[model samples]
Target: MRLLLLISRLDCLDELDALICNAFRRRGWEVIFGEINAIAADDYRCFTRGLLLPGSGEPCHPGPAALGNRETYFLDECQLVWVMSPPQDYAARDIWQMLWLASKRTAFVNSIEGMMFLDTKHALGYVLPKENRVFAYTSNDFSFLWERYRQASDQWWVAKPANAGCGQNVFLLPPNGPNVRTTLQCLTGNAVVQSLLYNGEVGAFKPEYTILQKFILEVANGEKRVVVVCGEAVAWYGREGNPDDHRSNIAQGGTPKSVELHSGEVKLAESIGLKLMEHGINFVGIDMAYPYIVELNIGYPNGLYNEMLTSGVDRSDRVAELIIASFENHCSLLR
Candidate 1:
């Protein structure tokens, strides 16, 4: 299968991309990098009767902005578009670009509409199921804002941006804590009040947890993440808080631990994957806590390969598998 992995020009040397490249090459697929800035054309026809436009960076296609604009960059191949950029910057900005692609009938991964919905924490909380068997969610209203955190039922709760990733804006809002107000003031929507699944039970989340349902938290420390490829899981480890803290997000100063998925986690992962697939949320990573899901990662996300490295799991193979599967399932339909 021929594939194009869209990414930033500077991220060309990314370790994650290297891993994916190695895996795709071993499969004998014609995998190429479509770094929007590297190519010289705004649009170039591919061997498969497909057109490749590298956005508005270095590649200069003769097409108009409507045909192709960097901010509004669009692809018509209708194949799988793997969104690997961070949720805040690329995820939000590219929302319309993706929407444009879908408006043209492109069979994008996760579908543009699904992704846009998942981009906001407020929207995620409003729509995610409270009890989907494989998934569970909870949330705290920002109505009282920080003061509501004083009524916390759990020892610790997380503060997160609805559309950001890599521990950029996550913080702990302990019951009656001092920073809860500061954190809430930094956010625009409601603050999520989730039960802390700390001390290795991070996989067990309360059924009422909704706002915290953006990504799956495994084990505990609760920041390491994983992805499922065709019912298979690739895991990543994150440290709990700091040596002095409790938030395990590596980007937040928590060290990465190796958390391999056991049978239960795998079972949970598959169940969530099937449900998401049914909803057309392909190319997704549902955050799992043992047998329940915390959130659905449908839009662009982060730390995928870094987490795999710390866990000793070779997920690049599964990435390749999904890439080929995307070529067959979505991209093929594009043609």
Candidate 2:
């Protein structure tokens, strides 16, 4: 079988992508790489520059359309296309829509429709009970934010972009904080702040709005990432934030360690994983802090390398097996 991994860029494949690509190749699957921005689509054909595996030393097969080290590929040729990049531009969105409409021919690991359902912070409302989930307010209006902030359960709130992940643009809002307005302004991009306060740095992705969630004190201990594949909890790890930082994302210098899920967490992860699988979202990483399900990572969930390093076992092998099995099962059902 053939698989196309849709990533943000070819030259910048991270550890997780490299691991997955190599794992699938070892399983006798022909693996090729495609960047979202380089894809050109039409009713007749879908074209892209198939990138060579980085650090492969030199190009072996130089096709007619080979530009430098890249090869030409047609989207219809691949049996499966695993999207690892979120659609962030017009070109990417166009490619996504084309592929989505042609999903019958090419199986998607997580369909764009599935990502739309549970990939963002907004998904918390659908997955979690009102009392169990974090109390969040999403809006671009300053008045709405002010009202929500005032009604928060605690004096502190976690302010972040609604669409971003990996702890990007996350901040702690102190009660009646001086930087409240400035932080909201920066996050929502509604009103420009003369100067950023409280270590507020501009993010890479521009967000349409922001989510102000009531801070959970229990997060001081740590957070958990439960990796679910094909509606089953396969592996999990714990992450603790760096000193003086509230963000527990490994991208933000947090530390990961091996851990087991509590009964409640196991039940929650299993139930949610099944529901997500039914919705065509097979691979996922569910983040949680005790009673609350923080985020659902359906687009590109990290931690495969970390799982191997911490547990001394390659879970990506299991991930690959499950993905192929699921894809074959889906194809069989269609047949």
lDDT (Cα, tens digit) per residue for candidate 2, span 35-69: 76677765657667776443233332212222236
Each prediction's number of clashing residue pairs: 27, 0
Query: What TM-score do all the candidates reach, one by one?
Result: 0.63, 0.86
Off by over 4 Å in 1: 35-80, 86-95, 102-107, 119-143, 150-155, 189-224, 234-241, 291-294, 300-304, 311-313, 329-335
The local lDDT score (0 to 100) that residue 157 gets in candidate 2 is 93
Candidate 2: worst-modelled 10 consecutive residues by lDDT? 58-67
Candidate 2, residue 6: how far the Cα is off, in Å = 1.0
Residue pairs in collision within model 2: none
- Show the lowest summed lDDT stretch of 10 residues, model 1: 59-68
**Candidate 2: segments with Cα more than 4 A from true spot:** 51-69, 152-154, 192-207
| Count of backbone collisions in candidate 1 | 27
Tens-digit per-residue lDDT, 1-335, candidate 1? 44455555432335554565557656755444444333222443221112333322232211121122223223444344444433334444554453444435444445455566554455433444555332213343444434445555245666665545555666655656666675665453322233232433544333221233223334363543557654455544544556765555556676656666677666666665665565555555555454444456655444466576575666777767774675476545755
